[model samples]
Target: MYLTQGLHRSLQRHPDKPALRHVGDGDVRTHTFAELLRDTGQHAAALQARGVKAGDRVALLAPNHDRLVRALLACWWLGAVACPLNVRWSAPELAYAVSDSEASLLVVDEALAGLVRELPLPVIDFEQLAQEAQGLQALPDVRAGGDTLAAILYTGGTTGRSKGVMLSHANFWTASMTRGAELNNAPDSVSLLVAPLFHVAGLGRLVGQTLVGGTCVTMAHFKPAAVLEAIERHGISDVVVVPTMLQSLLDDPGFAPERVRSLNRIAFGAAPMPPDLLERALQAWPHAEFFQAYGLTETAGAVCINLPDNHRDPAALAQGRLNSVGRAGLGAEIQIVDESGRELPAGQVGQIIVRGPMVTRGYWRLPEASAEALRGGWLHTGDAGRMDAQGYLYIVDRLKDMIISGGENIYCAEVESVLRTHPLVSQAAVIGRPDPHWGEVVHAVLVLADGATAEQLPLPVLRDWCHERLAGYKCPRGLSHVPALPLSAAGKVLKTVLRQQLAA
Candidate 1:
């Protein structure tokens, strides 16, 4: 299916239907299906006027807003690829992706006009671009389908320079259908799209809602109070968030059951979901259905999702279902394979490999790296995970995050999960601290619960606590306290930064 297929259908079925809404610092804006299509067409014409053609790359650097949405649709309309740059990046980081994507034109939000230094290409303000096209000729949908490049979404460079994952129209549609089917996106649904569009989780949610002709409300930035306000004000029925975002929303001073009572679906993923935080969310939104998605930028969106039924089922929870990212969704295949590509047995932790229609073709212009990653006809996800007898996938941790301490392998997520179970620990991140004798030692960085302090748990106390739940060798040998962990745009803990902190 094409990315904008539903938009055309909606234009025919219900032209006046509300399609998008944006709430930005007291500025509220909206667009109907007809309005959305017209805006998209005009934006497409604007790009065309600037010499953008089918198959050309258009770099989009903006936060979540109506103009950003229109620009994305405009690119798709002209069969051009949209490369959304991360707003959280430094000038160098943003320039790297822009240069790598070999973008022909830069479409930017005026607010971030100064971020791209030594601007290399012709730039058009997103607002002026759309406003200029108001009465211009409406561009026809080029109908770029399977294998046609749609968007170039760069991965969050938590480790190093980010790689742009090339996804097609079919890839987005596949992810939209797969994740939406599991999340149950209805036409009447009003999704609060607060996630940064640069990330797949946020962009995928936008695609899913648009594909179903559902309305999505955008927030320029993610703020818990604004999320509650949007849910209450716009009657938002669905939302997508990471574990950290979910916790903030549940703990936000403005949060109340009634304010978000309109929410019927909540989808979370992109990072580990702490059990304690998940439990708190469940209690706060007993009326909502919860979905846990698991995938990477290469996989478009979620390849697997722990469904609402399993989330709310007592028997399933007792059976440790909450720990699962769920079985592979339709059109996707999940496998745990050893280094040699041999499939591992159930419950054996190994590299998680995925194959599916939603899988990205490869990284932009990095054939050798692409071949290595997409080796054996499967995307070798760097994540270390295992599958149970029932095909439920349990994410352990990133393979690179695994620590070898005194010749013993220790997965950080295992240690972090146990640490989060501690009553006083609100958040935990584990890393390997270089030790002269042991080579590497498990080091724990923790964020304590409200009214708690580092004084409550010293290094020895933490080691003793971990020792009770973990093997002696796996127990942390070092401990530090942080008010909050540095995170990438997608909400994954920034271990590289943590390493720098340790060195300092």
Candidate 2:
């Protein structure tokens, strides 16, 4: 079945129930289940009218908004794959996804229309489409069965290249069901959606909540005040956030115990949480259940979770194993394999591999890349981890050249790609440096392009240029002018040397 079928049921069961609450531009707007259904149906009709066929790819480049969700559902209803791009990406980045997915139609909000001027694809402004949709009715059924592809989530690729992970209706449904079952979710539950809708963590939370017939209270964007306010204002029952987001909320002086006491649970993932920070959050709330989840985009965002009982146990929390991502879910198999491809014994570090119904089919249109990752029937997650005899999984380090900054993965190649574009850069190497707050920050070492000097191309100017081209977190924080970048025997930039130089 299509993923949006659950929303259809919710519309029938509680037509008048609040389905979404969004705050923007000094206004608070809401949509009842019936209204959302009507609008989405109209959107489906509009999409069909514009030649969006079953199995066609439709891409969205926008932030969190009611219209964004509506467009997604409309695409699902029409049997089109919803490909939502990261709004923070540069024009080149956005263009790469649009071209890679071979998206026939593009959807953008009013604010982002200018960014797509150079792209060759046809565009549909969502705001204008929303106006046009007001006069339409329910569209014809175009979807197929449960195995039909529903969405394409583009995740990490080698050397900062992009790879699209194809998720079927079954993949999404099973992930939501497995996570909901683990959490013991109820129909009346309410969830807070503060993460960007583009990420797997956020997408899974939204779909999981909807599957359980729960309400999602969304923020246009995450801010400390907005998060706390929504939790209090909407009586939000659940929240899925990264550790950085949780830390920011805890740092806010305006945060109150009473406001958080009403929440059922707070789920954190995407990056590891420091033990001290987790303890602080517990002391501040003392009421809500805390769960630490760990997974990748390939697993549909979750594989393991550290439950509330583990969080509250001093022994578990201190051994820091409570912070460890829990064992595999039902019907899921997790293995630790060495570099030589042999299965390692318990308590040995190796890459974590997962195989389950929730795993994605493969990367879109990239057969060789897909085969490399899906070899031996397991999704080869580039995360180094080990499992204990008791079966809990412990994440050790990233095997890939990826950095987790503020819960966002900043791949070294992606940063290097941008840095090479600089006029003053002949060569570049990007590395992560430890940050007390962000866990790690991107640092760049550059060898000047022909005639540039450190004084000629100041750090601020170089940073500003990169800020415009790359996502904020991916931009290099520290700039080092180098005489030459270290190279290996094969003539590849040696990142280890750069890291040592920075530390020294």
Candidate 3:
């Protein structure tokens, strides 16, 4: 049940198979399963030599690279917990994570080495470590128990400062196995890894692919042209992207039906895809199966996936089932519960809670936060959602994002969904602004389509558009145009950032 258990299986079953292919800055390098295993062993030995004993915390601050993957696997091999730091974080933020985790050593990419110079921990250059480990003997096997901590992944701090979500080997292994089974991952599958490995979804995809002996092609960073080129060149069969990345891919001039003809599946999550964008993607890559997954960092990865069949079925789209994040994944239990923690009935929106082996143990060193989040033995997802009689989970919006206007609760997602339907709108985000009379009023920030101006969608016109599709209170009272929305590393709209801008 250990995370590296599958890697050992892959080593024995497909030693010569291509395991990792890294594409960075026009350089392409690959490692066979055998090579990756050897590298993992060497990395483990190097870590041991550097005083990273079993149970030690090793922090990684690097972009996507083969060495980064090897470093993570090596940490698991040595029974050490790996803490992946977001590259987008500032030095102060990184300092907080490193100090909170009590990391003994930091492995940083050369590009980011400057950021960690002032940090107290001993630092190891990622490339230099690989060079040093080239001829080192393999470290002895040190297997970890299923419940042993494997990684401490920091949550994207949309609400506040980030907290480390401690995930055990069982948590990751369960998530990988469940996702692999549901997605029908196979040994021959070539998955393009475009998401940042610092995120759970990115790391989870790598683990899931490895569990089934699939080939993973890593991209240093996501660029629409580069992604399309990689797909065409490598004949990538599987890809996982967030809504923003999907939109960029569709908008890229290099994107075409022929470029991604080899794709067998495309899984999207982290945020809901606009209907217009999803429809465009479906048409452009008609041969590719589409899936939408739903999960938080605390769950390790996806616990619910909207299946390909549901995405392709026109009837399902008309019924709004396509908008759902799908049923509970294998071995996952999902429930909608009220504020008092009683389970809510189907068709009633409430908090979404999940219980499964895939869920994390708790946040690192944050007892109160952990207890509050994992209350009643379920991970309380602060999301407003409802389950249908047939078990489809429809996410309305984050409970925090709900706008309370004059005693009315307005879900921003509902308004954003309608706004996206307009041809002139490229992107839209709804937030609440202070109001003297209503307490809070709905405010819409929009990115117009190319060649379109803010004048094309004035407040009155946007108001009329929303009025046609929503109740009066739900319609945004104010409208503003932005060239782009602030996005998290996972390609989700950063509502916190939007709120700050509005406040200023």
Candidate 4:
């Protein structure tokens, strides 16, 4: 059940098959399963040479690259935990992660080598490691059991400084299998890797593809035109993207049905998909099946998935099922519970809790936080949601994102949904603003669509539009038009950033 088990199987079954096709700036490199295995073995030996051992931590700071994947596989092969630092993080932030994880070895891309100059760890340039490993003998296999720690993924620091999520080999294996079964990842599947590998969604997809001996086409970073070009050139069958990336692709001048005609499925998550955006995507890629995944870093990746059939069913859409994050994924259990931790009846919004093998063991070195989150034998996902009678889950919003104004509870998603329906609104994020009278009031920051302007859709007009579809109290009292909303690398709007700006 180790994460590297799939690679072992792929090597034995399809050694000469294409395993990776990496697209970088003016460069294209392909690797067969045999070649990937040989490189991974060399990398394992190299890590051993650098003094990394079982139970040790190895940190990586780089963008999506074949070398990064090899590094991860190499760590797992040696029974060491791989800590992938966000490439978008500042030097101080990266230092904090490496320090908190107690990583003994740091691997950085040649381009980012300067960022970790002051870090107190043995550093290995990614390219240099490859060069050094070229003539090294393959290390003997070191088998890690299912319970062995495989990775420590850090969460986005919205509440405070991010905590390290300790995931085991079992967690990664179960999550990949569960998602693969639900997504129907075939051995012939050719998946495009556009999401940052540091995120669970991207890394999990990479593992799933390897598990099935499928081809993975890696992109250095997400670019709408480059993505379209790769899909056309590689005939990529499966892709995972966030809603913001989907919207960007739709807006790109190179986007057309013909360019992605080979795509079989498009899986999306990391944020709620605006219905308008979903509708536009459906129109653009009519032949491709659409899926919406819902989970957290703690769950490895997706624990629930809205299938393509659910997306295309008119009755489901009319009944609001299309808005669902879908039913629980294979081998996962989902429940909505009241504040007292009792399971609630269907349609009642409560804290969404899950119990599954895919859930991470706990946060690294944060026992108090771990106990709080993993209490009562369930992973208490700090998200407010409801399950329909048939098991569809509708994510209301983050529990913290729920706004109380004039003693009425207002879910930001409801307001954002209404705001997005307006013809002029392209993107919208709603947050709670401090108010002495009401405790807090609803505020919206929006980006207007093409050919639209703030002058054309004034605050008064926007309020009226929201009023037509929402309760008077839920209508935003304050509106600000911006060209773009602050976002995390995973494509989620940084509501914390928005709140900070409002407070200042």
Each candidate structure's count of clashing pairs: 0, 0, 0, 0
Ranking by lDDT: 4, 3, 1, 2
TM-score of 3: 0.98
Clashing pairs in 3: none
Better-scoring candidate (TM-score), 1 or 3: 3
Candidate 1 runs further than 4 Å off: none
lDDT-superior candidate, 2 or 3: 3
TM-score of each model, paired residue for residue: 0.98, 0.80, 0.98, 0.98
Cα deviation of 120, candidate 3, in Å: 0.5
* Residues 367-450 of candidate 4: C-alpha lDDT, one tens digit per residue: 999999999879999999999999999999899999999898899989999999999999999999999999999999999999
Measured with C-alpha atoms, the lDDT of residue 15 in candidate 2 is 84
Model 4's lDDT to the true fold? Answer: 0.91
Candidate 3 displacement at residue 138 in angstroms = 0.7
Query: Taking the tens digit of each residue's C-alpha lDDT, what string does model 3 give over 1-504?
Result: 877776789889989999999986889999999998889989999998899999999999988888899999999999999999999999999999999999999999998999889999899899888987888999966878589999999988778888999999899888887787777787899999889988999999988887778899999889999999999999899898998898998999988888789987999988868888898988888888999999988999999989898988879977888899999999899999999999999899899999999999999999999999998899999999999999999998899999999998899888899999888999999999999999999999999999998888899999998899899889989888999999988788999899899888
Q: Give each model's whole-structure lDDT.
A: 0.89, 0.80, 0.90, 0.91
lDDT of 2 by residue, 1-504 (tens): 567776778877998888877875667889888887788889988888888899999999877777888898888888999898877667888899999999989999778888888899889789877887778888855655487988898763324577899988888778787776678877788887777677787778877876666787777677788788888888888888765577668878888888777787888877556555677788887887888887777888787777788888878867767747888876678899998779999998788999998898899998998899999899999888889888899886567657888897676755775687777776677889999999999898998866788998777888898899888888888989998876422123557667778899
